[model samples]
Target: MYLVMRKCDDGFRWLETDLGLDNLDLFVADGVLVGHLAWWSAPQRANVSTGDGAISCETSEIFPSRGICREKTKRGVAPSSPDCAMANLPHGGVLKDLYLRDAHKKDALAEEALRLPAVVLTERQLCDLELILNGGFSPLEGFLNQKDYESVVQSIHLSNGLIWSIPINLDVSSEQIVALGIKTGARIALRDPRDDIPLSILTVEDVYRPNKAKEAELVFGANDPAHPAVSYLHNQTKEFYVGGNVEAIRSPSHYDYVSNRYTPTELRSHFKKLDWTRVVAFQTRNPMHRAHRELTVRAARARKAHLLIHPVVGMTKPGDIDHYTRVRVYQALMPKYPNGMAELSLLPLAMRMGGPREAIWHALIRKNHGVTHFIIGRDHAGPGKNSQGKDFYGPYEAQELVEKYKDEIGVEIVPFQMVTYCPDSDEYMPIDEVPKGTTTLDISGTELRRRLRLGLPIPAWFSYPEVVAVLRQAYPPRLQQGFTVFITGLHASGKNSVAHALQVSLNQQGTRPVSLLLGETIRSELSSELGFSKRERDINVQRIAFVAGELTKAGAAVVASMVAPYEEAREQARSTVEKFGGFYLVHVATPLEECEKHDREGIYKRARAGKISGFTGIDDPYEVPKRPNLVVDWSKQSVSQIVHEVVLMLEQDGYLGSS
Candidate 1:
């Protein structure tokens, strides 16, 4: 009996054998005999051909081949070389490995890098550079030049007509452009910001300013500050972008997740060794849970493919769980899957939260990593909500966008089906499959955080105990966590006295260590050279916020008192400190006359006499708190009374227990 299998447009081929051959099976990859497929059971013969050595089997399932580089199967093209034995071909047909592995060549480049002007890479830029060097960002030799950048921003395609959604440009200040003499044809050293170690030397091809508004509007769907990427572009990104091709001296160093960090070439080789030709890649920046596991397993099973749990380890959403904790969660989830069915790997990707556009970008990245299929879930890479609290994108917008270009991308899009737990069956099922009026349970991210904060029980069916244990360790109950009380007002508005009283009260309560960040004391110790200009004050307040955040993360109660007149600076401080712990902004609202009257040091008098220029509330303005948690007037409230009120607020927020 002879069996025939033909490649299908969906990147899978059918298996066929005569009923006469019950015990044996054949494995064919691109019409070439590779091995024996012994895993399938006997199937009934659907059709028989006597003259032609071919028979059709009853099994219509699309089974993946064991040893074949699945290229664009719809194109019916065969692998070009023997080297393409397994794994999917990288996007754009080539895996550009830019790493100079030869010892002598690397040494020469490293020495040459010393002579060129260096641009220290930001965290996000380092992530991009690493991928470029390793070919995870295949076909991208280096940062995008002006032509390609404009094309990508406008049409989600490179200037060459290749689909490249996100623009990868080396952003720099105008000062750096002049100081480093950066322009077309100039060479500059790209160094790691952490250690100043040279990683690559780049030959600049184009230097230009990007139209951020146009880019944000077209690429991100909105130019809203609430979108993290838009906010970053307007607030943080430099003025000029330098584009160039880089010759790598060395890849970026990563001490953690060493075993799981695989370059594109290495990953393809590993997949080939495992004889896995069809891979389904799961992308996540958040920690995995039972729902995620079910979704991925179902997708893989439906596709008859192995699973790759690829999580982003670089900058994610600002408040997302740290990669270390997320990695641990993923590790905990590995054993839950059937053995040898899944693998975990870290992708050092700096996510732009670009919603639909980012979905295509992720698909291309996975395709470059030899992934045949990618899972695009609801609101994939979404940036939460806009300033008006409406979702930035529809739930299925990412899936629809990915679906529109899946064939062109050469990576099948597996739309993630939302799963919920059914206690009646003690299992998870897709939300659509669950019958109406049936009891179902699900946890939202907000609810999970609330439960974790309040030390509430998380049902075992929702997540594994091992995973919950890791999360609990990372996020202790609110009572056990620390908090910061930030006081801001005009000078001598009893800010220091209130801060001191709060510190003493907290210390006496003894739930955690207490830290006091008094403005004058900080000025002498940490900001002696910083004058009281608006800019200097912002810097001083930012330094105070940094220390307070550190203390809060260390499980300490911090009371920071500063004249922080500008609301923007105060808001910045709140954002910084709140990442680690709770932040309470206490506005000391004593009248300006009352403050001047209580100024024992005559600083206000000196400011009135023009001795102190830019004295807040005297020469400079003090923007009143727009959203203070607690407001106290020293003329109406005593220090003890204010401390008691602050303590009550903390207690109510569950930051205090038996204290």
Candidate 2:
């Protein structure tokens, strides 16, 4: 049985006795073929007869193959190219951006047509969807399923041998799958978590639990928590992986910076209109300073290419400057670049900080956007340090890796030229180019943060005044901002006493709104239906975190006391609350015997009498905090003394008064 695959646009027609290398099992692209070939671009069916061994397709004119080398099936989206990709480099036949054409725009489903079951997207998932629809991840129609994910993670290659370093799949909790009653072959809608709008439909292809440890080691190069990506894999992601192709019914609706968030097709069109054929792209999570501006301009001039100032506005490192602030900084710094030399755009990618692998992944992404060159700095995409207090990757590892695959990646790697300010010359010069005897001045990132916290003057030579002003506005001195004080201990372990006393004290001072989330009150109101099971307890803690977060964002000083017995749950609470303000975890390390004896409610008596099920200190376990800001044992001290210690912590952390 012979399978025939034919394309006519560029007189490309070749079919062997059977299919081979590609996932389609019918088409081969290994460059070693012993198959008979034929030119099948004839006008009519009778023109090429059975004797000539040619098969006719339904369409009158078949175009050149311009898409992922997929498993060619009878029913699939027809291969087509976008106008924006017409000027693609010869070697990189990157598939066209899917969002460019008029047809795909019509694929959005009406609200009335959407089914009952929908998965509300998280911030990270939203970032992924934006890229898939915008064609930043070209040739990937949807999230990866089991086959694709295993291949991508284990080998950094798709089943068809495409280099894809990271696994980008939609994850859901096992509870969610059961709640939705999802089956093997069901169509589910992906909804925006922010607004609940139906964005796309995913046809289920596989449902399986992944080996998370394996994934952490293979994909992130470490299973340690010091790596941000590894921590996210264990803490943020759910249990099950759902895989399927997406039919984009609508792009994500955004209310902020609409103009700056450009898709590949839009950028490609703009470049075409500007007559910018050779473009160099710069990617950053931080605000652009004077040195960065100088480096990028010099790189573009060196390559004779126009500049694209593309910054990631999606989730970056945990504690990164909020995108709203960074975008403002970017806008302010734009005028510093030579006029007509640069254009600004935003990339909504949740960075993995994979160092070397991520650097290559970034290059491939830029190549898809019609960029001919990309800038790679020392330790590109590096995620700080490991638990051993050592850099995860070598300084030049990213540059070296990208250069190793330069030919296949299609984008030229531009090593970052470290520019240092020279007082004598009054100009920025490369570090190596400077005279040996010349003195150089520099400021570290930690130093910059210290300066911002204290409202110190930032040197104009280091950054533009406009950028510094914007940063100062976002990171106001810690004394004027909001913060959270989370206290956890066993039941009736003086947690409530301390929290209530702390609340009253802060209110007496009355500099900020003092809010309290006590355990009993929340259980009666927010979590009345929840039991003492581990899952239910976790849910209760999260509910408290949500309320605390909103209050903290409004410049309030929030004090929460609960039986947050799990280390993981407490960590989650910290992550949620810290996004808006300071989060200080205080473990009431009162000994179990002391806590039981100090209980005035007779709760310990009931637990010993077997009336209370799943008692925390009796049957269930309590994970001790290895490092809490303060550990108060009222048995050895007074409640007044404990409260005094807590207040001191607040004052020292720059939340109470000017530090």
How accurate locally, in lDDT, is each candidate? 0.82, 0.77
- Candidate 2, residue 333: how far the Cα is off, in Å: 0.7
Q: What is candidate 2's lDDT per residue for 120-222, written digit by digit as tens?
A: 9999998988787666876576788998899988987776666777788899998889998666787888888888887777778888788899998988778
lDDT of 1: 0.82
TM-score for each predicted model, relative to the true structure: 0.87, 0.82
User: In the order shown, what is each candidate's alpha-carbon RMSD?
Assistant: 10.5, 8.2
lDDT of 1 at 65: 28
Per-residue error (Å), model 2, residue 94: 4.8
Best by lDDT: 1
Among all windows of 10 consecutive residues in model 2, the one with the lowest summed lDDT is: 28-37
